[model samples]
Target: MASRGVGAALAIAAAGLLAASALGKGWISAGSASVGLMGGEVCRGGKCKTLELPEKDGWRTTGTVAFAAALGAAGLGLVAGIMGLARKRSKVPAVLTLVAALAALGGGIAFILVAPGKGVMEHLAWGAYCGVGGGVFAVVGAILLMRAAGAGPSYAVGMPGTANPAARTLMLAETAKVSGPEAKTMAPGMAMAPQVQAPRPSKGAPAMVPPCPKCHGPLQFAGQFNAWYCPRCQSYLQV
Candidate 1:
């Protein structure tokens, strides 16, 4: 599961993509001359040229490339967020987040380096700054998510015992029980036998009688005489 901090960071980074897209358009001022850059209308001497993504130049323009990268990063962020929240966690989310951050970062850099304006004094617009900021935040969030994924349940190290002390103890105890004296003391020739107890009589059941004294045969009880007698012996039994 993605930590709350990491999730929040990814969300913020995704927002950066929007910011970057919006900020990548603006004018650069040079003395008295102002020129529009990437994704904006360039004005020089009252003449204007509009540039947009997938420009008429067949997507080869610097503006298109930079914006594309930013878009890619934003898409990756969404995917990473979904994967991070999956029931079964995996490294995919972390990888996706990292790729997203890198894409955004690269896009921002490209936007500055490949900006479509020629001016003696060029000033970047707020949108460019937002893109850069969002990229930075995304990178930070990705790193955190990766660390969290790898750490797993053992995130907290150097604690009193261990991260999952109860589980460890249960495992150890089970191992000990299996390897202890009762398991090891069995003889080669003799097998371990389960203990069998005599059946107990019910509360209202008659009591049992001893076998015959002479023949050790089954005995019969006489209710009227209030005495027990042996059938095979057929003799008066002593009280």
Candidate 2:
């Protein structure tokens, strides 16, 4: 999913860069002159040029640079998304997404700074749109990658130690320990008595036991109210 999203984003970015480059080239080819007409009067030529306007001599080079940067960032994002989906065990893709997002932002800023006066606002608008969109895609991809690696919201409860199977088994064993006349008689002179095992279910009985909600672990059968309990985590649940 992340891979597909990144690929789509890359395609959009590539198209945007191509359009911007084409527009910039067209502006240069049309003779770097400004023309304005107000009522019957006409204003034209170098008198309309402003200091804030990008220099004509190097504008194409700058546009090319901006386009290249945007392409590079989008390429990186695509690679990161592919890695994230394929590996499913590494955080490298998440880090790569963040880097790609920053690169896209930088490229957008540079493009805005070097754009010509006539379409400067339009250029900046497109750049801002691409920057923001790329950034959002990167963040969402990073989050999905983290989730795929099992390092995010799913395990936010705690680490693996307490949820270990062996640990849970031990806890269950402890909880199953018994201490009555029948337990002592079963072991005779033993210092500690063995647990009183619950009767095995009949052939037609349910095979899977329910789990406790709090710890999401298997629960032990408790007869009276058709309930189950997680001895390890001390959680109760309806059977």
Model 2 lDDT-worst window of ten: 34-43
Which segments of candidate 1 are over 4 A away from where they belong?
A: 1-4, 16-24, 27-38, 42-49, 52-60, 82-88, 116-122, 153-239
lDDT of 1 by residue, 1-239 (tens): 33635664564566555445534554344333322224555556978766443343332355455566566666666555555555224656657766766766775565466544454224765565566766666666666666655553442332333345565555445435434555433324323223222233333233776666667787565432223456776642423
Cα lDDT for residue 222, model 2?
47
lDDT of 1 at 55: 41
Name model 2 segments beyond 4 Å from true: 1-65, 83-87, 122-128, 147-194, 198-239
Candidate 1 similarity to native, TM-score = 0.49
Model 2 Cα shift for residue 49 (angstroms)? 22
Question: Candidate 2, clashing residue pairs?
Answer: none
Give the candidate number with the greatest lDDT: 1
In order, candidate lDDTs are: 0.52, 0.45
For residue 113, give model 2's deviation from the true position in Å: 2.5
Whose TM-score is greatest here?
1
Tens digits of per-residue lDDT, candidate 2, 176-235, equal 432222323322332321222334433324367655455556667643212344676653
